[model samples]
Target: MAEILAFAGSNSSTSINYELVKYTASLIENHKVQTLDMARYPFPMYSADEEKQKGFSNSLIEFKGYIQQSQGLILSVNEHNGNPSGYFKNLLDWLSRLERRFLEDTTVFLMAASPGKRGGIGAMGVVQDILPRFGAEIASTFSLPSFGQVFANGEIIDQTLKEQHSEALDIFLQKLN
Candidate 1:
């Protein structure tokens, strides 16, 4: 079975992005999905000086190891003022320093969700452009706007949105196989 890494780019305890990631990951069949909670793996803010004094943190290294072992990744991002959440950006910054090609050749299913009408497109766009530079092969991209209105009870409430999400999952799964 294919192994997939699923995570949301936020650290909030009740992160809507995290719920979105989990819901999407569940759509995959015959795969082992590993969910990553950014809140659980907090790290020191990234800095060149800090890296010089202290080597990569154990948590960061462990997280990268998981990425290396996974066949594909499903990432749902949260936006904070038209940018990636600090927690997710910090993690990505640190990981890039450790391995320039951190996501090299890995298939990625990129997604974003928010309560706002634009969803988390701001953060999603940033990742869409930058992740490829780190060698990510994006297989699909989906954005769920106005997440609070579209999602209910841990699933997408809007039938139309749910169908689109399912289609996205099919694309992701096809790429995996």
Candidate 2:
């Protein structure tokens, strides 16, 4: 079984993306999944000067270590004004500086969820474009729209969305195996 690292893009304690990812993680059988909270990794805003002066923080190093140890990634990103959240973008920046190929040799299962009708597809699109540069091979993508209406008790409630989510996840797991 492959080591899979899962995490959501937001730092919010009540992030809907986190809830979605957590539920998705539970659905995986046979694989070893490690889910993380971005709040646990508090990196300073990325800047050339910050890198030159202090180098990477312990939290960033630990986060990168998880990536290095994992062969697969399950990521759920939140949106901010039709773009990936700034917190997530900044984390990517810091990790990229630490190592340009942070996600090298790993396949990513990308996902997003939002209360809105579009879900977080805008953020998902931005992430889809960016992660490959860090060496992530995107395996599949899923978006759960209207999170409150569709998800409950750590499961996808809507039958159609559940089927779609299952298919996407099955494809990703198949690629990993």
- Which lDDT values do the candidates have, in the order given? 0.91, 0.94
Clashes of 2: 0
- List the candidates' TM-scores in order: 0.97, 0.98
Tens-digit lDDT string for candidate 2 (17-135): 99988988999999999999887777789999989999989988989999999999999999999999989999999999889989999999999999999999999999999999999
Q: Determine which window of 10 residues in candidate 2 has minimal summed lDDT.
A: 37-46
Pairs in steric clash, model 2: none
Error of 2 at 60 (Å): 0.3
Instruction: State residue 74's C-alpha deviation in candidate 2, in Å.
Output: 0.3
Clash list (residue pairs), candidate 1 = none
In model 2, the runs with Cα more than 4 Å from the true position are none
Worst 10 residues of 1 by lDDT: 21-30
RMSD in Å for all candidates: 0.9, 0.7
